[model samples]
Target: MIFVSLYLFMFCKMEENSGHISVADFSKHLFWDVNKSEIDLMRDRHYVVRRVFSCGLMNDWNLICRLYGIQEIGEIAKQIRDLDPKSHAFIALIAKIPEEDFLCYTTKQSTPQHWNF
Candidate 1:
């Protein structure tokens, strides 16, 4: 029982720190443009979950709630994936960072200005 409790505690701490992990670390692990600042992820797991959800990436509510204290990342991801191409583009525009911003960061462009509106 004690060992089980200890393992659970460690697991929770690991997840907490994982959510606090830097964008660079996450990018290195995933090999994709997260398109958000490091500070954003460090804020809170819920924030990151919401960001991912906004991108239409959350579909499994139970998993999302368990993983990120939210309940929609899996559903959103599925919805985005199911969208028609043009409609997906529109949805992406509504939820994601502007293409220019994502491009600027991906290309390592310095002093890049994000969209004002």
Candidate 2:
């Protein structure tokens, strides 16, 4: 009974983790606004790429690139309208894409410093 239970437990653990990338592996501070475990990579790719590339460190950047590739990441990042200039430039350079090709660059907003409450 003990041997069978142990085997089952290990097998289940392996099955659950096989070829799956969980958000929990990212920097904890990056996901403070949401429940980390509920994030599905395929379904939540836009959110994941936006958060990791915008707010995460180099390691996080490398991880996402390895998992999703530069082409895919650039495609997603280009669509985000509010990405900061620094982050936008970084991705544009690494992805080897012209700045004008990005939607964010083509439709950038003027500085919001003049807005009043």
RMSD of each: 15.0, 13.4
State the lDDT at 65 in candidate 1. 33
| Per-residue alpha-carbon lDDT of candidate 2 for residues 13-55, written as tens digits (9 for 90 to 100) | 4443345556766788888999877888778889989998668
Instruction: Please write out the lDDT profile of model 1 over residues 1-117, one tens digit for every residue.
Output: 456434533444455323333444432323244544544533555444444334433232222333542113222433332233332343234334343333222354344336422
Locate the minimum summed-lDDT window of 10 residues in model 2.
8-17
Which 10 residues in a row give candidate 1 its minimum summed lDDT? Answer: 56-65
List of clashing residue pairs for candidate 2: none
Model 1 misplaced stretches (Cα beyond 4 Å): 1-19, 29-70, 82-117
